[model samples]
Target: MVKVRLWGSLRQAAEGQTEVEVEARTFKELLDRLVETYPGLAPQIARGVSLSLDGVIYREAWFTEIRPESEVVLMPYMTGG
Candidate 1:
């Protein structure tokens, strides 16, 4: 299981939990598992969310490999002009 830290607004969607664990070997799997476990997060996830592995943030990187011990953070999708 990969432990993901919920950042900012994501904690509320994750049932107020700051951290969560899900079985995932890749970035896509992590998102899938999160929604499956926390239905409240569905809409935001569908709209878009980003994952930070170690220190790098990823958006739409479905195939990115994630280590079980990696520092993972889940947050709202980042946008820039």
Candidate 2:
């Protein structure tokens, strides 16, 4: 099981719940489950979001390859202007 944590507006969509569990083997799979379970969150995720696994930010697609009991956190992408 993957632990999925949500922040900001995403939290609201999850009924103020901070965490969720998904049956996914990888990050993308986890994301797909999220979109499937929470239809309301789909738009926010589609707009581009950053994900962290077990506290560290996952920057490479490689993170999506390993199947671990992960703690996945989602937040908006940061941009420097």
Candidate 3:
């Protein structure tokens, strides 16, 4: 199980728990697990949310694999004009 930390508005979706545990082999899997664990978070977690693994930002496609002991942070998207 990987430990996932929720931030900002996501904390609300996660029932105000700053941290959660998810079973996953990849970052994508983590999202899938999160949604399954907390159905209410699906829509929010899907909107270009970025992930950080062990405190390092992970880019697209980098989510293909995950470390078993990794700690992930889910952050809302940042949009610019």
Candidate 4:
């Protein structure tokens, strides 16, 4: 299981959890497992979210490999003009 830190509204959807764990080997699997485990997180995940893997933030990076020991965080997607 990979541990993920929640940020902003994600914590609310995750039953007020700041951190949670899920079984995932890749970004896609991680998001899938999140929605499966926490139905409340579905809508926000569908809209889009950013991922921070070991200090690197990524957007829409579905296949990114995640290590068990890597730091992972989920936050709202960011956009700039």
Candidate 5:
């Protein structure tokens, strides 16, 4: 199981949960499982989000490998005004 930390709006979508556990081998699979477990997150996820794995941020790394102990964080896309 991977530990996923939800931030900002993503946390709101997940019913205020800051952390969640999911079983997946890859980043893409994690997202799939997340949406499956938390249907409310689908719309926010579809809008676009950034992922941080072991402190490294990724935007389009769907194939990134994720281990059971990996530290993962999910947050809404960041932009500058």
Candidate 6:
């Protein structure tokens, strides 16, 4: 299982859980599993979120490989003007 950290509204949507464990081999699978496990996160996730894999952040690199022990962080997208 990969370790996933949630932030902002994602945490609130996930019932205030800061972290979760999920089984996935790729980034896309991770997102799918997260939404499956927590249906409420679907809308936010679909709108857009940033993913951090082993300290690297990705906006839409779904094909990124995720190992069982990968450190992952999922958070809402940030924009600055």
- Number of the top candidate by TM-score? 4
Candidate numbers sorted by lDDT from highest down: 4, 1, 6, 5, 3, 2
- The TM-scores, one per candidate, come to 0.94, 0.79, 0.84, 0.95, 0.94, 0.94
Model 4 ranges with Cα > 4 A deviation? none
Q: Which model is ahead, 1 or 5, in terms of lDDT?
A: 1
Residue-by-residue lDDT tens digits, candidate 1, 27-80: 898989999999999999999999888999889999999998899999998779
Any runs in candidate 3 off by more than 4 Å, and if so which? none
Q: Where does candidate 2 stray beyond 4 Å?
A: 59-63, 66-68
lDDT of 2 by residue, 1-81 (tens): 777778778888766778888888776777788889888778877787778877777643534653456567877666799
How does residue 36 of candidate 1 score in lDDT?
97
Tens digit per residue, CA lDDT, model 5, 1-81: 888999998888888899999999987898899999999999988988889999999987899999888889999889999
Q: Candidate 1: TM-score?
A: 0.94
Evaluated at residue 14, the lDDT of candidate 4 is 91
Q: What local lDDT score does residue 55 receive in model 2, on the 0 to 100 scale?
A: 76
Reference-based lDDT, each prediction = 0.92, 0.74, 0.80, 0.96, 0.90, 0.91
Residue-level lDDT tens digits of model 3 in 1-81 = 888888788999888899998889887888888999998789887676778877777656435677777768887776689
lDDT winner between candidates 4 and 6: 4
Off by over 4 Å in 1: none
* Best-performing candidate as measured by lDDT: 4
